[model samples]
Target: DQQVKQNSPSLSVQEGRISILNCDYTNSMFDYFLWYKKYPAEGPTFLISISSIKDKNEDGRFTVFLNKSAKHLSLHIVPSQPGDSAVYFCAASALYISSGSARQLTFGSGTQLTVLP
Candidate 1:
């Protein structure tokens, strides 16, 4: 099954606090994991990513940790701002074929993150 699972449908937090979102996968073939942030009616923006070779990746206030042994991953946002309030999606990809061979990612339903100002 291509199920990338985000157990929580939503999260709410006050500003300047930490926001953590979790994800799990059934497919062990996934070699690349990515996190994307989306606003309504817009495409998700690539935030950060971790190769299966690495256990963690970070960018600015965002961090992602992957536990290959556990088939699990999480995203952490420190001091979350109201601007951070949006849908966060966890996606997994395995190598695919094409001229460019763009990786095909399996996406979770997404977790809506709301940060209070």
Candidate 2:
């Protein structure tokens, strides 16, 4: 499905700089948003998340911003280090009541961020 899209397939940034990853979603029902970082031969790990009620959320050098009206979200990394280089995925989920359980996610293809020295 084209529910989530990351227009840029890759990104390059220098160490000690800022890196911005963009994502767009077509589904308005999505309320929970997340970002994941992954390395080669490894599964994606959760990085940060934001609920539709909030506009921004931050954790250390990583920050996620959600704009509900525009159906857009972005992840920002400040003073990015070489170790931050990895593929980043944007995910979205809508709460459902099926089987009294929820939390299935729709993920964007991914954006590869390369941090240079």
Candidate 3:
């Protein structure tokens, strides 16, 4: 079964509005969470991340919130712009062993965001 999941397949928002994306994880071992944005055929670009120890992390217009108890996380983009239109993916990383040398990321399918101009 997929460890990470994004319930929403797509979201549309008007330019200059707020865009909210959500993700859920089933693994309690995941300690790190990241959000990536992809533009068509290009590789996914890192957006924001939050550690399990932190409830919230923000950068400029992007903010990530984590609810450990619920095993859920969310990404908020304020004042969404047309350039922000892309596919957003939620990823979770965890160490496979006590050595912490083998860490892998499990990613959600993706959520396409469309910002109407």
User: Taking the candidates one at a time, how many backbone clashes does each contain?
Assistant: 0, 0, 0
Query: Scored by CA lDDT, what does every candidate get?
Result: 0.93, 0.95, 0.95
* Model 1 steric clash pairs: none
lDDT of 3 by residue, 9-116 (tens): 999999999999999999999999999999988999999999999999999999999999999999999989999999999999997777565677789999999999
Q: Candidate 3 — which residues are off by over 4 angstroms? A: none
Each prediction's TM-score versus the true structure: 0.93, 0.96, 0.96
Writing each residue's lDDT as its tens digit, candidate 2 over 24-61 gives: 99998889999999999999999999999999999999
TM-score of 2: 0.96
Model 1: CA > 4 A from native: 96-100
Model 2 lDDT, residue 44, Cα: 94
Model 3, position 3, has a per-residue lDDT of: 94
